[model samples]
Target chain A: MNRTLALVLYGIGLALISHFAIVFAAPYLATDVVIARIDKVRALTPNELRVAPPTSPPRDLVPMGNADTITASSWLDLRQGPLLFEAPLPRRGEYWSVSIFAHDSDTDFIMSDRDVQAGEPARVLIYGPGQVPPIQSDAIIARVSTERAFLLVRAIMRDRNDNADVEALSAELRQATLRPAP
Target chain B: MGKVFRWVATTVVALALGAGSAAALINFGGAFDARIVNGAWETGRHTGSASADPYSRARGAIYGLWGLPPSEVVYYTALQDDTGQPLQRSCSYQVSGGALPARWWSVTLYRDYFLIENPARRYSWSSTTIDVAPAGNWRIDVNAAGEGDNALPMGERDGVFALSLRLYQPLPQVLDNRATIELPAIHRGACQGSSS
Candidate 1:
């Protein structure tokens, strides 16, 4: 090939490689800040829900978080075993939701208060790709594609003055357990 | 030696340009499947899901939409007015709509993905807090001076801003048929100047 053609081919090859590199690395780099924040909160215990410190104007690890609700999150390593996650159903006239995201940031599954039967707590059994629960019960079974994932919980508050109530709800959610399934 | 040096420089520049442009397009390009509503607002059809493309995933990460799915929460954003002009902070506008199908919803203002700092410290209004007219319609004023009971204070920032409307627990139809959803209308009002 001529000198100019060889140079053009070399540049095109480099551009393609760089584009793919960025595509593969984007999720990890973009989610690093949030992962770090979740790590700080989850350092005390693994697979346990960590209630983020309440901040005025709502300092969320995620951008554009809902100012109307208090959020709690947990990082799950399902390789250890299946995890049993549960949360109390919201009171009447209130709204709440539990969303599980894969390591790649895809939302694997979501459960809302409306999904739960009347007066029943929200419960789900999350397992890795190869693992299966011993028995199927009333709890929702969610199979994640990746061994590592994130669980974000949100509960609405009436207003800013309702921080006390939000705190109470957060405390209730802190009691949400992530334990090995029987 | 000169030939080797020139080839290295060309390769480096090409790689940098390619990677930077790819990342920028994924994060900023309006190429995803966003259904337009009311001639102003746009909502992503598959924001946080396995079906989302790489660009959508990158955009979702930048937007800090961690775990929630479209079924649980549908987000609608408007960076322009009904006339397709940029939403400037200096210009006042009115957002009016009827009750949405979601169990709860809110409209929030953000500047470059962060909440705008205002003296009132208010960032959003939910279904429970927003006032409704007798005819079941509601109106919110977007003003820098913080006018009206339902005013979303724009603060002193200039340039373009964004309005994000979150519909939590929307009805099945709203998710299945987003193009026909009855979203709020954004009508531009008076523009004082570029400063606000």
Candidate 2:
């Protein structure tokens, strides 16, 4: 091949690689920034749930977070082993949900209040890639692709003024626990 | 040695060009993406889902991390008004619509993806907080001065902004017919001279 043609081809190849690398790394970098910020404020630890008050204006912990919902989250590190995630459900006819997001920003699993009996607690066996499921449990089975994932719970506060009810509900959610699978 | 230097120079330039273009697209491209467009609002078909494309997933991380898929929630964003003008913080607008096809819904204004700071401490209005007409229609005023009962305060800042419509537990019809759903129309009202 001609010298000029070879150089052009090499440049094009490098450019394409650069472009795809940015596209692929964006999610992981974004997730890392988010987790770091959340940790800074909440001092988050693995498997320990922390509930946030309604998103205050001017600055919200998360972008586009609803001001009318009480939210709680727990950082999950499943590299060591499977985790048992338990969540408490609110009354029927209320809007509430628990979702798990993988490191790549995909929704690994999501369950709404309607999925379980009203006001019943939810249990799930969360395992990462190559991890084994627990021997026995009625909990829903969920698996994520990455060892680093997170669980988010959102419950509507119909009346932002009367937040006592929602506060209590979020407290109940905080009671939900995560621990190494037995 | 001369030929090696030329190759190195060309490769460096190519890498810079590629990285710069990628950054620009990720930052300036439509935040919610354009997989589906209904009127002026748009959404990503697989946002926050495993099936999402790379661009969609990247955009979701910046604009809506931890967002649910369309089955649980649908998010539509409008960066411009009905007239194709950018939504400015210096202007007043009227958002009018009837009942939406969802169990619950809300409209919130954001600047750079964060809720605009206002004295009312109110960043959004939802189905539960809005005053519905006897006919089930509702109108929210995006007032610059933060006036009116059903108003989203634009604060005193001056710049472009976005309006996000989130429908939680959207009805099956909405997911099936995303392109035909009737979203609220934003009509530009008045604007501060030379600022909008």
Candidate 3:
């Protein structure tokens, strides 16, 4: 065996170790970029969840009979909790919302306009894959009961500026007033 | 000579170990998505400590990292006008909020993405006007039609029950969309005892 050949092999090994160490230490040398990015940006909240459960829970429940004058009331109780209305909900302006009784609870949230399919049960999700974090009234619920259930609703008014007009319109809808037909 | 051989063996093992750990980190990190949408990344979080039901917390953490602007979703909840009036199922909902899109925007409804077939002709918005709102923030009504009303027919018995809100093309400062939006609380319906 040649002594020069052995020494040359040892030199090659030393170079490789140095290279590997540098590569391994690169991340630490680069001032924690990932950590800094995380620190600088704030985490966004799921607006849907926040809206469903406001800072304080509503502390009352009342029943409307077969013929309750919804228009006469200051505000109606909502049926079902936030879980019923799915996420990525539309802001309250001019769309219709449905209220349903949560299966085993007394709470309720307004249904989003997206889930109101005629002739089917509303069964929307609260959160799901590739979806925005807001909840809406369009979820298809499995069933609905009219026994003074909870109801929280938002509407998308065709006329944003006509607040008083829209409020009157909403009251009219709630009243369900109909004229006699010949 | 024996010591040298032992040292070489130990170095090889250590290298192998370090390589394995780095590989694991990359694999786990990839599971989370980070592509930008409408100039910002939209993601989720399930941090509601009330129910630690399975993937809720994990999903919540992922949402926190996405860094997208938040919009108001507070209006979607069910409750009376800051009172205890029981709302009903046979009603419609109107939604509106936030600024218009600069580079595309949309509003979608989901029971956690299990979308329902709305009675209305429209389902979501990526481009333009809905039921109608003068503000850049739009609104649409979700319910059955009637007089003096431009309503989209609703699911008969299956009318809307629960829902969520999503804002796309969100402005940068709407960071506290979650904390700031004025949402209603879920009030319990009258007890069966009261109804009976």
Top candidate by DockQ: 2
Residue pairs with backbone atoms closer than 3 Å in model 1 (clashes): none
Error of 2 at A63 (Å): 2.2
* Candidates, ranked, DockQ: 2, 1, 3
Expressed as tens digits, the lDDT of each residue in A24-130 for candidate 3 is: 44322221332233224423122121111101101111110000011111111222222333223222334444432222221233344454555443344332222
Error of 3 at A122 (Å): 38
> For residues A19-51, could you state the per-residue lDDT of candidate 2 as single tens digits?
879977988888899899888888999877788
Residue A35 alpha-carbon offset, candidate 2, angstroms: 0.7
List fnat per candidate, in order. Answer: 0.62, 0.71, 0.00
Candidate 1 positional error at B73, Å: 1.8
Worst 10 residues of 1 chain A by lDDT: A53-62
How is the predicted docking of candidate 2 categorized under the CAPRI scheme?
Answer: medium
Off by over 4 Å in 3: A1-182, B1-55, B58-88, B96-105, B109-113, B118-120, B125-127, B131-138, B145-153, B181-196
The model with the greater DockQ, 1 or 2, is 2
Query: What is the model-wide C-alpha lDDT for candidate 1?
Result: 0.76
Q: Please report how far candidate 3 places residue A35 from its true position, in Å.
A: 34
Ten residues in sequence with the least summed lDDT for candidate 3 chain A: A60-69
- Per-residue lDDT over B36-121 for candidate 1, one digit per residue giving the tens place of the 0 to 100 score: 45478877667776676677667777775573667778888898888898888778989888899988889988776667777777
